[model samples]
Target: MTTTISPSRKTNEAVRPAKQPLRDRLVRLQRRIPIVQLALLVLVCAYGLATLPGFGSWMSIKSILILGALVGMAALGQSIVVLIGGIDLGVAGYIVAGALMVTQFATLNNVPFGVAFLLATAGAAVLGGTVGYLCHRFRIHSIIVTFAMGSVALGLAQLQVAGAYGGGAPVWLTQMTSPVMGTLGLPIPPLVLVWAVVIVLAALFLHRTAAGRRLLATGANPRAAELVHIRTRRVWVLAFAFSAVASVVAGVFLAGFAGNVDVTMGNPYLFESLAAVIIGGTVFGGPGDYSRTVVGVLLLTVLTTVLVGQGLTGADKQILYGLIILAAMAVYGRERRLRDQV
Candidate 1:
């Protein structure tokens, strides 16, 4: 006897078996951890310990958290933009402008801190959105536009200060930088709480939302994303806007940490932020990776504090950063080429 299987039944069988659970895929992704980033973090921490006593002190620990929170926030912001095949040099502008504006409003104009915060974030969003729009609408390179915009922002920050700049932090702002509580006999800085919230929200936004997946898709292949009806332009705009928001928030934290703001104050963040993103295992053309960026931020902050404790000058920091940037790019570029070849 010959048995006949219907085509529909065969198709159904294939379809049912081909379906894989989302949880399993997520488990696999988690297993494929970025080991190198974590390893580098360990190495950096050890070096910091070897270099300075401040690496272990409560005061140094507090400073690292504040600085890490600020730089990590900025790096993560840049990571968002970077993932979408666009670079945001304007993040520097946002840091300078946002800090200056927030402080200017709170100090010079007597605007409430809450109101100033909103205004500063709004301004950053506008600036970032403008870059996003220009990139999508005019097909301009974000690198060029963002770079120019950043310069413009720096100039505006300088003008806003008008020689009235002094590094005096508000009482409330200072309080925010202090420890909220202690754990295991170690004080935990309040900024850690804020950073944790930002990171958690960021992770959820990028991993658990449709918009987040679309962002990844768009960055992976804009043409393919468009073909799939992904609304790539909207993705670009939103990514940039989000990045701007991160930059501004970072600026606020940094301004609080520094107890003041200046146009040149944000200068170091530009290079360091990009470097942190790179070292965090988020390569060029990669999507936002919140956890790794946080690690990178800590590494950099620790390194910075260590150097400061050793009385290292600005030139020494620059040299160290320059070397790290060069080495990171060399490694990433080579690996990318190898991956492409593979």
Candidate 2:
């Protein structure tokens, strides 16, 4: 002050702009993220289509959509559990059990189609609820419990199959889900429509309902939520129940699609569900949304379809898919940490 500041220094100080609000910056960053990811996905799909002959064919597109729809349903359930800071390792088990139940009731046991389907779903839900209770009451880790439960479920399915091969789907279920509706020669399966509806409903529930807020809070910080009088355990139980219900619905579609039930039908979906959730930008133990999961499913489906269409073997496709999922997790992890730091 005694020496008087230089005019250049004063001008420099005066010209500095105020920093942007942290929330505003975060919002802007988030807005850009989805667009970037979507653009990348689209580009990858386009590259595959351009380079691979027949990749853009109607059959190819329909196959991709159908596979994505099935995996996406299970992935949605997994996402719910992951959002609640839990994992359901019993996805394959529940799906197998549900399908077996449906098949047995409708075919072997000669029950009504509608009744068989409802009972199958209910059975799966009960199984899920029991697992949830065990985890909550006995302080068992969900992963271990669900994994063990999956084994049990598989064993039960095998028992039901009893080394027999030819019990097909009920006529009604097959007729209702077949014919593959679409627009302008594009094949759109009913299962795809079902998945779209489920995802949309789930998104609305999570974003616009109090129960969803509680569920999210429980996942974000169980202790804090407990202190605020939120029944964290109940939320967890419901999450597990929902996961089971979703798996059963997926099983119904699988049964309809395959036109038969096998003991091993649901085994592949376990990993696929996990992959879809992670790829969908739902970080473990963090905020998750259904819309992102849908994108994740589509990306995965497209990638797999393109690879298969290019004559890549199943094993190679799986390896590449794992790599992609790892890359996605890395990116999402960095972004999450950066947000926390800011």
Best by TM-score: 2
Model 2, span 267-323: residue lDDT tens: 788888888787777776676677777787888778777777678998997898799
TM-score (all chains, Cα) for each model: 0.82, 0.85
Candidate 2 — which residues are off by over 4 angstroms?
A: 1-28, 31-33, 157-165, 175-179, 182-187, 335-342
Error in Å for residue 325 of model 2: 2.5
Clash pairs detected, candidate 2: none
Residue 182 CA displacement from its true place in model 2, Å: 4.7
Candidate 1 lDDT score relative to the true structure:
0.75
On a 0 to 100 scale, what is the lDDT of residue 234 in model 2? 87
Worst 10 residues of 2 by lDDT: 333-342
The models' CA-based lDDT, in order, is: 0.75, 0.77
lDDT by residue (1-342, candidate 1, tens digit) is: 999999999998887866569966753453356565567668877887787665777776676787788788888778888777788887788887778777765677777778877877876677778889889989999989889877776676657567466645577676676655444455777777678788899889888999888887777677777888999888878788878888877787778777777667777888888888876656655534777677778777777777777789989988987787777667555543212322
